[model samples]
Target: MGTTARETDRERHDEVPVLEAFTRFLGLQRGLSPHTVRAYVTDVGQLLEHLGGDEDADPLARLDLTTLRAWLADQRRRGMSRATLARRTAAVRTFCTWAHRSGHLAQDVGARLRSPRPNRHLPTVLAVDDAAQLLAVAQDRAGDDDPVHLRDWAALELLYATGVRISELVGVDVPDLDAGERTVRVTGKGDKDRVVPFGVPARRALEAWLERGRPALAGPASARALFLGARGGRVDPRTIRGVVHRLTAVAGVPDLAPHGLRHSAATHLLAGGSDLRTVQEVLGHSSLATTQRYTHVTPERLLAAYTQAHPRA
Candidate 1:
């Protein structure tokens, strides 16, 4: 159950003034988005509450490296995922650093606080043949003049071709595409814009959707959107997710989400000898580290390749 205002007040009453001030600093000074700021505040709130368990403790003054480590250990005991624990560690460290700099504490206790490295799980990706089969199924269903069928085919094709995120996919507008150049301009995280390329299959799918599919569903709410729902409005990510799930179900493959399509795209690109820097640009990743995670090949695959080709073996 969520805390009531009274419960929250009692839980955080001792640290309310400092927490409120830090939230303002995050918003006004650091310019963090409301969602991000809320996450940081919530993480910090948990830390503060943990420290406030002692009735007369000065939570701010007691914010030490020991307290920060204890908070992370407590989170681990709660069966939280390693990623969540890593984020909580970062949040608390950032909060403590800022508080110390602002004179809330005599020393920067978080300066030595280390966030745990998050576990890296290889993303679930479709093999090339599987991706081909998935798209083939969508295309088969799109053989008729149904706008819904056409949209599904194009959405899948574009997803696998460009490796764009779901938000970037659904946010595409008609003018975002350049048919002649076969590129789509996308706005990604951090409000960064880049144009990513697609292939002939995607081009054909996109053309068919725009010329036949989109127009049929184009209501006033569509507002120049590249993809439209049955109700003639811009397609929601939820609807796109349903389309992906339906496509995978029809293909008789493992349940694949939109992100799986993106993972497949990036993995295939790496397999095709695309350089990491080029792939990073294509995916609009601000950090190359993120792109590496999405496309890291297995050691087993490397060993298999060596055994097949090495003359000494």
Candidate 2:
């Protein structure tokens, strides 16, 4: 005789309207990406479903610290990771704050809600030799003058050279590149743009793609896209991932995705004496703490320097 969570969601009075408003706030006011906005909305929607309040009552009004904790506990019981729980907790907190500001809730109930810190895992990175081999294999493949092969070669080069996320890489426009300066402007999370510099090899590969490869594949729909798909549309993240995975295997290196190339680039930069702040700017990380993860990947290099420089050693 109890109302199911789905039934309660269907009968709610303000849930739909509140979620719609929250979605708009996240996208328009917060300037979050569509993917991020969808995630926050999905998390809050699940929370609303879990609340299962009276049909006439505003569910947000009933959202308090205790209710938020219970929802997170239920999520934990369902085997969600700490990272997922943390993100959900953040979503609820943001929603509660927004609802309070909009006069829907009496107060910000989730203001005190705490997110569980995610477990830190060192990301997989290829050795310098392996990365060289990967690019060498790609360069060899591009020798045939095939457009797709040339594009893949350039993609891998830019990915490792600049350490950009796949989304940023794909979103790059032809006009964004300043070839003379060897810098490309990438729009990162929250649509924030930063200029990242590439080395001579990346610049050369990119020039090849632009001069020889792109013209062969460019079509009316290609517009200003720097990288085009086989069908002449803007390159997507999935295709870039497949290209990395395929080329990584061909190079006889560790199996990895585009993100792995990002990790390798960051690690190599640190090993090559690049400072944390510089890498932070290069990777467009909002926090230096985010860039600090790469430092952990260079323990052997750290030990060598310590052994050589420290008099106490």
Top TM-score model: 2
Tens-place lDDT per residue, model 1, 1-313, is 8888766556654677888999998878877646568889999998877777555456776778887887788778989888888888778778878898888888888889888888986657887898998999999999997999999999999999999988899889999999899999998765578999999999999999988888888988887789888999888889999999998888977788898888888888877768789899999987899887768765666676678889997
- For 1-313, candidate 2 gives per-residue lDDT tens digits of 9998767757656478889999999999999988789999999998988776566666666778987898798879989999899888889899989999999888999999989988776667899999999999999999999999999999999999999989899999999999899999999999899999999999999999999999999999898999999999899889999998888888899999888899889889988878889889998888999888554546777887888999997
On the 0 to 100 scale, the lDDT of residue 205 in model 2 is 92
User: How far in Å is the alpha carbon of 78 misplaced in model 1?
Assistant: 1.7
- What TM-score does candidate 1 reach? 0.78
TM-score of each: 0.78, 0.91
Off by over 4 Å in 2: 1-14, 307-313
lDDT of each: 0.85, 0.89
What root-mean-square deviation over C-alphas does model 2 reach?
3.8
